[model samples]
Target chain A: MILAVAWRNIWRNKTRSLVILIAICLGLASGIFYMAFYKGMVVQRINTAIKTEASHIQVHHKEYLNNPDKKFVISNTDSTVQIIRSNEHVKAISSRVIINTMAQSAKTGTGVKITGINPEDEKQVTNLSTKLIEGTYFEEVKRNPIVIGEELANKLNVKLKSKVVVTLQDMQGNLTGAAFKVEGIFRTSNTAFDKASVFVRKSDISRIMQLDNQASHEIAILLDNNENLASTNTSLTEELSTLDVKTWREIMPEVSLVESSFGITMFVFIGIILLALLFGIINTMLMAVLERKKELGMLMAVGLNKTRVFTMILLETVMLSLVGGLFGIALGWLLTFYFGYQGIDLGTWSTAYESMGFDTLVYTQLPFYVSMQIALMVIVTGIIAAIYPATKALKLKPAEAIRIDL
Target chain B: MNVIEVKDLKKVYNSTEVKVNALNGIDLTIEKGEFTAIVGPSGSGKTTFLNMLGGLDSPTSGDINIGGTEIGKLSSSKLIDFRLQNIGFVFQAYNLIPVLTALENVEFIMQMQGVDKKQRQQRAKDLLIQVGLGDRINSRPSKLSGGQQQRVAVARALASKPTFVLADEPTANLDSKSTENLLSMMEELNKQEKITFIFSTHDQRVVNKAHRVITLEDGKIISDDRKNE
Candidate 1:
């Protein structure tokens, strides 16, 4: 009966109830959609970090990362690669001869880090082959074929089939120069990575620098699934204690920070929205309680206890909030679904977004648990908002309330 | 047997600068199966005295023993339970829960008593029938007229099977015909069911129908008349 009374009581002032209901609905809907949008952007950035920039894990000579000197190469790379390949989680691995050098085009010259890789092995480790804006992946140009980024190509004033001279100091402290024709121009989301990096055939660079073909500076590994990244990284780290083995998270801490701090950011964002809606709910419920002052007094006079009275008010407020919350969740889900499928194109700001390693076209994504958490938060907010008004209702003196003119 | 016993019942309102005596040294007793009226002009303490009798308010100095229980000694929570079990009230404005149907309004009191649903429903229906609101049981209070709403209030008051019903100006908003109808119904219920009724009113019609009439002035009982005596 109390439940029934509370349910019916909310409809007493339809306009007032609906005003607050709509306020909660719109507030939570926007909050939920914004959460989904941010999650999508972060997930995309993480995916790009792993697939394009850093494979699930990377292995390098202990001092090669600290000092990218060509002399700090990992010896006996074949035996180390064989040991890592035996791990069940290992999907693909590519050894690279990393050389920080200068490349000179006919029009200009700029500093560049040349990644020397086996084309076939690199295909499985990185998605650079698929990111080609023009030309083939080390296929069309047969002699000293190189892949450069669109940003780097623009900087060098080079186009497909353009011959660029790479100048570098070899392992013997001698200046070496080689001519390479651009076989591919790839454009990744990270403009900085695009501008500073170029890839060449590992055999070509190793032979030119008089280095042993079996020795390389870095080994990049891609796992079958990122969930296996930790176990595989630990296994490889223990097996190859002589080399530095680091997962993508350790390799890119900024991206890792964004992924880990997403929950707190969401909490603060939705908290602000619910905090605003909380006062609106309180004001509405207080008015409802005040409007029904005489009725409440009569209820007490007729032997309705204070706890029951308080519960009735609480129930009314919760029902109102839950109804609005459910609607908000539904609306938010619908918008997320629509935008997630079609994608929200930030084409106008694509340059800025891409410069920061974010895809311009984002597909909104939220885990099922996140929506459940938001629903729970809404219920908690409703309970908190009900407190003051319900307490006020409990304070009404039955004798005086019954006699109240209104 | 007496259902309510009072001794030196007094109520004082303490303001910033004045202490106004609402109920001054009053004494009264009401027996079972009696229909009584407490009448007075405004500020004569008729409402305050009724409030004390109903356990809705505490007297500054008094012993109100209703059915072997000293109400003033009970905690606020226990006092509410005492009222639920022993007293029923019908306000002057016919304060039915506006959202509930007439049947629900009547059943609500029994619900508070934790009565079985089927039994309460049947009793609510029967009570509404007795109060001449049988056909309008499904109508909410707003849909009912002032007189009809009052009838529902009376049915609601009787639904708890309380020791006595306290009516504070129950007929003050009713027309003559509705007043006469309501009085006739109360008179029949008092005679037939032995349900005690205590009313605080300025209505002469109610005073004329009561078996006993107690009038107050300046917070003191000025007259006590009994037609049966």
Candidate 2:
């Protein structure tokens, strides 16, 4: 009966109740949608980091990462590649001869990290070949073909088929330079990576530096699925014990941090939104309790106990909150579904977003469990908001309240 | 048999600078099945006496024994239970829960007493019918007239089957016809069911209908008149 009465009481002032309900609804919907948006952006960045920048895992000469000197090379790279290819989870692997050098164009010069890779092998490990905005991937030029980033091309004042000179130190620590024609200009989301890195044929760089073709400074591996990353990384670490093997997470800790701390960030964001809505609920319930002081007094005088009175008020607040919360969740879910499929284009701010390695077009993503958790949070907020008003109702003296005239 | 016995009932209101005695040294007893009225002017403590008798307020120094149990000695919670079990109240404003229908308003007290659903529902229906509100059972208080709302209040007060009903100017807001109808209905219930009724009223209509009248002046009972005796 108390439950019935509590439910009816909410509609006593339909306008008042709906005002608070809408406040709660819109508040939660915005919070949930914002959370989904941010999660989508972060997930996209991590995906880009793995697929386009750093493959699932990488192996290097134990000291090559700490000191990028050409002397620190993984000897017998052909045998290492063969051993890695034996793993069922390994989708593709590529060996790279890396050197920190300068690329001088006809107009200007800039520092760059030149990566020498077998075009076919590198194509399987990274999606750079697919990101070509200009020429073919090492097809047009017969010798010393290079694929440079759009940002690097802009900075070096060079275009497709432009001859650029790469200055570097050889394996014997002697100054060496070579001319390579830009075969392709690729543009990735990460502007910084695009500006600083360039790729060329591994044989051409090895022949020029008088280095052995069987030695490599870095070995990149791509897995069929991210779920196999840990297992494949561990297996490769054990098999290639003499080399330094690391996953993408260990390679890019900043991106890993964004992925790992997303839950806490969302929780805090939603918490603030709920906290603001808490006061609105409290005020609405307080008005309801105060307005019915005389009626409540009559109930007490007629034998309704304090516990039942408190329970009635609590139930009213919770029911109100739950109704609005469910609607908000439904609305948020609908919005997420629509945008997740069609994607939200942040084209206006694409430059800022792309500079930080985030795709401008983001597809909202929120797991089912996250929406469930938000529902639970709404219930908890209702309970907390009910306490003060319910307690105030409990403090009314039946003798005085009954005669309060209003 | 005496249903309520009061010995030297005294209630003093102590404020920061004043000590106004609301009830001063009253002694009285109400018999079973009696229709009595406690009448007085404003601030004469008639409401205070009724509040104390209903166990809604505590006395400064007194003993109020209702049906062999001393109400003053009960704790706040136990006093509430005691009121639920032994007393009924009807206020002037017809303070029914506006959200509930007339029938639900009547059944609410019985529900609070943990009465089973079917039994309480049936009794609530019977009580509403007895109050001449059988047709308005499904009407909320806001939809009913002032007199009809008071009738619902009376039905609710009687649903508990309390030892006695305390009515504080129940007809104060009613028209002459409604007042007469309500007083006659109460007289009939008192005569038929032998249910005791104690009222604090300023209306002469209620005073004329009572079998006994107790008048107060300056927080003291100045006259106790019995009509039939």
**Distance from true position, residue A377, model 1, in Å?**
2.0
lDDT of 1 at A127: 93
Which pairs clash in the backbone of model 2?
none
List runs of model 2 lying over 4 Å from the truth. A76-90, A210-213, A224-239
Q: iRMS of each prediction in angstroms?
A: 1.1, 1.1
Candidate with top TM-score is 1
lDDT of 2 by residue, B1-229 (tens): 9999999999999875789999999999999999999999999999999999999999999899999999999999999999999998889994798889999998889988989999999999999999999999999999999889888988888999999999999999999999999999999999999989999999999999999999998889999999983
TM-score of chain B of each: 0.96, 0.98
Query: Candidate 1's residue-wise lDDT over A123-149, tens digit each?
Result: 999899999999999887778999999
True contacts kept of each: 0.78, 0.78
Q: Give per-residue CA lDDT, model 1, range B134-176, as digits (tens).
A: 8999999999988899889889888888899999989988999
**RMSD in Å for all candidates:** 1.7, 2.6
Among all windows of ten consecutive residues in candidate 1 chain A, which has the lowest summed lDDT?
A397-406
Model 1 CA lDDT for position A27? 90
